[model samples]
Target: MDIDVNDSTPPAPEEYPDVDGEPPAWAEDRTPLGDAIPWFRKFQGGMHTKEGILYGLLISGDAGVRSYIDDEIIITRTGGSSERDAEGKLSQVADQKDDTAISRSVNNSMKFNIAVGVVIGKKNKILKRKLPHAFNVMDYFRVAYVWHERIDGFIAVRFRLEKLELEEKSWWAEKGSPAPPRTARRKWVKPIEHICGACAQTYYRIYMQGWMCLNTSCSQFWKLPDGNDPPVELDYDPKWLDWRHDPSDEVQPHYSLVPDFMSVIDDSDPNSTYSRTSWKNGIVCPSCKQCLSRRFWDGWRCDESCGFKRVLNMQTISLRAVVDDYEVAPIRRAIVFDPGPKETALIEPEIDDVYSHPYRRLVFDLPGAGTVTHFVTNREINAKPNGPNDLFIQLQQANLGLRRYPLSQAGMPYGFVVAVDSLPFSEACDPILRVMGRLTWATHEATDKQGVTALIPNELLALGYFEDMAINYHDDGEDTLGPTIASLSLGAMAHKSLRMKYKYYNGFTKGSKKLVHDDPVLEGCANRDWRLDLKQKLDNNELDWPAYEAEWWRTYKANKSGAAREAPPCIKTQLHHGDLVVMHGDGVQKYYEHQVELEKGGGAKLRYALTARHVLPAKIEPGQWPKGQFQLTKDQDYKGT
Candidate 1:
C-alpha cells in the first residue's frame, strides 16, 4: 500500500533493483526487511516514504485478532441511564475509557493503532519491572505511543519506515507461539495535534495521556471539573515547618556518658541518616569523618561536603495495627521542637563521662512525652519511674514491646518526633538493648593464625563487634592450612580457608647454602614510575641483571629435596560469604606471599567479594615451589592481609 505519510509518491527502492548490472555488497543476500530498505539514499528516498510500513505474518498466534475489528458501532450499546441505543444511536460514543470494552473491540488500522488488549487504562499496576528495558514500545502515533501494562501482560512490535511518507512508520507484531486470539488489522487514529497538552504544558485534568508536569509554574493545568473532589488542606502555622522538617536547631546530645563520644545522628532509621530538612532544596554531600556524610542527602547543593541529601517523602505503616476500617486513622500528634534558634549543630545527646550521667534528666530531645523509660536490670526498657532500677524494669517492658515488626522497622522506636513525649538520653541504650539480645557471647577469644589466641579485647566490644554475633558463626573442630585461613567457630563452623605449601627446611643440608644479605629480586614495578605495555610484562625485566642472576641461582641450591609430591592435587576450598580473613600480629608477611583469585561460578546469585592479601617485599626464586596465587611465607610481621 502506497501510504501518503511524507512528501511524494515514489517507487519502492528494493522493488526496482539492478539485477543484471551489479548489486552493492550490502544489498547482496539481504534479508526481507534489510534488502527492501534503501539505505544509501535515505534523505532522497525518505521524500517518498515518510511514513514507514509494517508486515506481519498471520501466524497461528495472530489469526484471531481480526475478529475483534469494529467495522461499525454495535447494536446494543447503552449509557449510564440504562436506555438502549439502536444502529446509529451510539455511533458518536468514541472516547469511553473503559479498557475491557476497548480490548474487546481490538481497534487497529493499517498505519496506526490504539488497541486496548492488555494495557487498558493507566490504572494497571506493575508488580515488577526490568527498568530501562521495561516499557520499551515502538509507536507510529507519538501521543498514544506509551504502552503501559499490567503486572503480567507484555507488548512488542516492529516497523519499516519509508522515505515518501510524512511522519513515516512501518510496523508489525507477531507472537512466537500460538495465541488464543490475536488481531492483524485495526483502524489507525492519526494524532491530529503535534504535542499532547498534558505533555506540552501543565495539565491537571482528571484523565489524559502522558506524565503531566507537576511544577506549579506550568499552565494547561486541569481544573477540578464538575463533580470532582479536591485535595484536603489544613491551616497549619509556618512554625511547624522548622520543628518537623528542619531540626538542625533542636536536637542536642548529652555529654555525660564518656564512652558515647561519637556524635552520630539519632534518626530512627540509621540508614536514613540523610533525612534532609528541606525536601526540594539544593544541597550537596560533604566529606564526613565517619564516612556518613553521603547518608544524609537533603537537597541539591552549591558545593559538596555540606553533608545533606533528601530522603524519600513517603512513609509506610503496618495496616493490621489499626482498626478494621482504615478510612480513619487514630489521633497521632507530630511535634517540632527547637532547643534554641541556633544556626547549626544540634546533635543527639552525648555522654562525656559515666559519672556525670544525666541521672534522671531528659538528655535527648524525643518527639513525644508519653513514654518515660528507665534502664531495666534485664535487657529491656522500663517505662516506670520509681528509681534507676525502675527505669531498668521499664526498659525491659519496652524491649518486649518493640520486638514484633521487621528488624529494620522495629529497631527504630525513637519514632518520628511526636508532640507529647519525653524520652531520655539512656534511651540510646534502646538500640543497645536490641544489640544485646542479638549477641550470645559477652566474652570470647580472638585468634590469629600464628596460634596466638588473645582475649577478645574490650576494643571489640566498644566497636560493636558483638552486635552482630548472631550472624557470625564457625564450627567446633577444624584443621586448616594456608591459601584459605580457617577459624573454628563455637557452633562448629569454619568461615575462611587456609592452604599451606609445606617444604622441609632442615638445619643439616649437604650442599653449599647461600646466606644472602639482601633480596636480589627487584621490587614490584608498580612502585616504579614506569608504564610498560603487555610486551614488557612478558620480557624478563626482573632478575635479568648479573647481580640477580647469581642470587637466583643461590636461592635454589640444595632446596629441592623433601618438596611435597604433586599427585592429583584435589584442592579443598573454604570460600564463604562475608567472611573477614585478617593477617595479624607477627612479622610473618615480611616473608610470605598472597594473592586473590576471581572464581567462575563462585557466586551465582548474591556473591560479591573483595580481597586484601600479602604481597612479598622480598625476592622469590624463579620456578620456586609456592610461586603463584597460593604462595605463603614462614616469617615476618605484616598485619591486615
Candidate 2:
C-alpha cells in the first residue's frame, strides 16, 4: 500500500484545531456532522492504500477522472436543439443554465453533504429526498493536495451518487409530491415543448404537466399525453427548489407583529404616564411622532423618515392621529342624513354615558335641522338637504345589490363602503364628513394627553345585515384606524357586546392586578451599549423579547390567582333602532373584541348600520377623494340642487 503522500503540505494552525485535536471551547459538544468528519478522513486515507487506489480516486497520476454534468460544459449554447448522433439517441449533456443552477443549489444545501455521509453508513440503504429522485452514494473521491503554494493547503472531496428507482407505493406519490419521475415509456411520453401533436399548434402547459390540446371543441383526455411522459426537468435553483421542495425539517424564525425597532420594558418611570399594558405614553420623535426606543435608534430620530432628532432624558408623549375623522348613519326605513356639524354635537354621547344608561338615547335640536331623536325616531323636516334624494336612494340600492363580503376576505370586519359616488366632500358626503368632525371635536377623553382630538371619522361604512345575521367578534385595531369608532343603528335593534381577548382577559377579571416589573434590567457599559447587542440578537432571530415579556406577564397574572382560569371579565351593550354608539378610546380595541347580533323580535327585518372611522392617510385609497379636500369641503356649502 505505497500511496504517494504530499509531504510539502503546510502544518494545521494551532489556533484552529481539527475536530480530533484539542477542539475550541465553542465546539463543546460534537454534532452528528462533526462526528462524521473523522469517518470521511478515514475513507480518504483508505483510498490512498495500494488496494484502494484502483478506483481512480486521486489526482497524483492520470488516474483522476472528472465527469461534466453538462455535455457542453466548455461552450455555451444559443437555443440549440439537444444534439444527437446519426443514431437519433438523446445527447448525454445537460442544459448549461440548468447544470449551473443545480450545481449552485447542491453546493448551498448543507443537507446534501450530510445526507451523503449518512447514507454511506453501515446500512448503505438509499435515502429518500424531496427532489425528483431518491439516491444512494456509490463512490467517494478526494484530492489530498494540489501542487500550489498555498498556506494551510486543503483537501476537496466529491461523491458519486446514483439516482434510485421511484417507488409507486411511497407516501411521496400518494401525497402528490411535485417530484417528477426520471424516465417514462414511449407510449406515455409527450413533448413538453410548446407544440402539441394533436393540435399542431403552440399550447401552454398551464393546466397540468400533461396538458391536453387546447381546442375547446376537441378538448379531451384522449388528446392529453399519457402519464408516462418524459420526466419534467428538475429545477435545482434555490428559488425554484424552494417552491417545489417541502420544508419538512426546517426551523422557522418566530415573528412578532410589534415593530422590529420596538421593545417592551418590565417597568415604567414613576412620573411617566405609560400605563400598565398600554401604549398610551411612550418616547416619540417630535417631528413624525413615531415610537422611539433604545433598541432602534439614537435619541428620537427615526433613521428611515424625517431625521428629526431630540434629546430626551425620559419623556413620554402621545402621538396625534395622522388622518382626518369621518362617519355615516342610516335612519329607520325613512331616510339617512348627515346631521351637519352642529347637529352631530347635539346628538353626541358623553364620555362615560354608556356607563349610566346601558341603552341611553338622546334628543337634540339643531339650529336649522330641527329637533332630532337619537335611538328613537329618525327626523328631518326641510333644512339644507343632505344631498339629492336620488343620490342617497341610489347608494341604498347599490348597497342592497352589492355582494356580501366573503368570510375568507374578512381581514377587517366584513362590510361595504358607502357609495361616496361623489368626492368624499361632495354634497352627498360633506354633511356626513361634518358630522364626523363634530364627533371628533366632542370626544374630549384623551387616551394620552400629547394630543386632544383622538376620534376622527373620515371613512363611512354602510353595513347591511340579513335576518339572523351576526358579526363575528373582532377589534378594529389596525394602525390605520383612529382610537374612536361611532355607529348609528337603523331599521332594527341589535345586541352588541364587548369582551376582553383571552390573553388580556385576566387583566379585567375580578381582583386580577396588572403584572408590573419596572427595573433597569437591560444594563449597558460606559463604552458599549448593550441595547445594540439586543437589537442585533433580535435581527439575527436569536431573541424575541417582546413576545417573551408578554408571555411572562400572562403567566405571572395566571399564577397570581393560584387557580387555573381561561376567560376574563366582559362588558355587553345593546344598540337599538336609531341608537348612537361611540367607542371612546383605542384601549378597548387593543384589549377587546366586539360582536353584533341581530335581535329577532320583529321577525326577519333588515338592519343597517352607519359606522365611521379615521383611517391613516397612507391607508386611504388614492383618488377616493382628491387631496387636501377634507378640510376644504368642511366649510364649503353643498351646491347639489
Which candidate leads in lDDT?
Answer: 2
lDDT over C-alpha atoms for residue 349 of model 1: 32
TM-score of each: 0.17, 0.30
Q: What overall lDDT goes with each candidate model?
A: 0.21, 0.33
Error of 2 at 92 (Å): 48
Q: Model 1, range 1-641, lDDT digits (tens) per residue?
A: 13223346543432321211111111111121121222111211101112231111111111111111011110111111111145322122232222332222222212243211111011111111111111111211111221211111111111111111122121111213222221223223322222334445422221122222322333422223232322321111112111111112222211110111123333353222222222111111222211121111221221263434333322221212111223212222112333333322232332222221221111222121111111101111111132222322233233321210111111111222121221222332442322222111111111321244433211111110011112211111111111122111111111222111111111112244432232212122111112222124325555444544354344435444343221111111222211223333221222222222222221111111211212221332333212222211222111211
Q: Which run of 10 residues does model 2 get worst, by summed lDDT?
A: 70-79
**Candidate 2 structure quality by residue, lDDT tens digits, 1-641:** 23233567443322221111111111111221121122221222112112212121111111111211210011011111234447543232322232243233323332332221111221111121121111111222211111110011211122232112221222212133344443342123222435656557664342233444444333332243762422322122222111211223341211111122224333244122122112211243434433333221112334564675543232222111100112122332232333235311213322322422322333322222122223322222111243222222333333122223321111122223222222243333443453344334323222222254554455555555544667878877777676666665654457775544544433223355443222111111111133334345555677576754465455545546444243322334445444455565555576556788876543333455656666656665565434213553444332211
Clashing pairs in 2: 189-229, 266-517, 267-518, 325-456, 325-457, 325-458, 326-457, 326-458, 375-578
